[model samples]
Target: MSEPHAGSCRCGLISAEASRAPFWTSYCHCRDCRKQTGAPVMAFVGFRDEDLTWHGEPRSWRAGGVERRFCGYCGSQIGYSDDRLPGEIYLALGFMDEPERYPPALHAFEARRLPFLHIADDLPRYSGFSVER
Candidate 1:
């Protein structure tokens, strides 16, 4: 079998792997995402929940209608899931072992994007979630 896409928490206390290709990749410009990831734009890779597996004790919490997971020891955000979008998992791109393999297909919450960060790409942009979601 091919090697799965994998990654770990900053301190390596938590790890995750995906056996299947991701469903979607996106850049989220929402303030909630920025606050959670401490970045102007947060890239995310989405996959079917069943295709992904997690290791170690990652703490989870709900905020803004999404359940976010993080390493309790290092406080590094690992990923998030939303009940509204069942059977799907979204991992933080920066935490991915091979992020270059996943490129942002669209921009989410574009209206909330920071002024200083300008991306010239012509990827679809939406004020909220893209129509695909």
Candidate 2:
């Protein structure tokens, strides 16, 4: 049996646990994600609703009509839930322990990727997200 995956906010106020490994992982370069995360690119792990649980109330806000949650005290991003991907929550990979274990398999919104950042990898780059997810 595998152990549940875990993550916590910088201030340790918000914590999360997933009963199973993520089904999808990717890097997003959309403007909304950039602005919200204060990064050129953002990595996320997609977990099913039934497999994930939260331990604290994370502060939430909407941008581009999508809901994102984060720790209010430390501003550590927790994740986002998109209506387009119903029953899935995309959590910020940076907050997870040993994040190297959940490497992103592809890049999303590649057209919007900032010029200053370069992720030289052969991973399939998508102008948008993969349809299968």
Candidate 3:
């Protein structure tokens, strides 16, 4: 197996590894995503759950069917999973060492994007989850 790509929380108290390349990458503008990240949008990279491994005990909670996990020490959002997208573990793009390696392919929940924020990219925009679009 090739060496896995690694990521850590802001304070380095939580870390994870992905043994395989991401299945999908996107920027999410859903209200839920914005609220959790404290940003106008959140970038995410998804991997099959089996390809991911966690190094620290991250705190987690389920909300609106999504299980959100984060570093307990620094409060950096680490990752999340939704039953609606089975078998996928989505990590915060900013946590990765080479986040630019996975630029967002599209914008999800464009309907909820903040009015003040503008994305210059010409990537496809979906009103909801890409699967639902």
Provide the overall lDDT of each model, using Cα atoms, as 2-decimal numbers.
0.89, 0.87, 0.88
Which residue pairs in model 2 clash with each other?
none
Clashing pairs in 1: none
TM-score (C-alpha) between model 3 and the true structure:
0.93
Candidate maximizing lDDT: 1
Give me the displacement of residue 113 in model 1, in angstroms. 0.7
Candidate closer to the true structure by TM-score (higher is better), 1 or 3: 1
lDDT of 2 by residue, 1-133 (tens): 2766988999899998888999989999998889889988999988898987788889999865579999999999988988777888889998787688899999999999998889989999999865454
TM-score of 1: 0.93
Candidate 1 Cα RMSD after full superposition onto the native fold (Å): 1.4
TM-scores of all predicted structures: 0.93, 0.92, 0.93
Worst window of 10 by summed lDDT in candidate 3: 1-10
What is the Å distance of residue 60 in model 1 from its true position?
Answer: 1.4
Q: Which ten residues in a row have the lowest lDDT in candidate 1?
A: 124-133
TM-score quality measure for candidate 2:
0.92
Question: Per-residue CA lDDT of candidate 1, range 27-103, in tens?
Answer: 99998889899989999998898997888978999976789988999999888998888898899998898889899
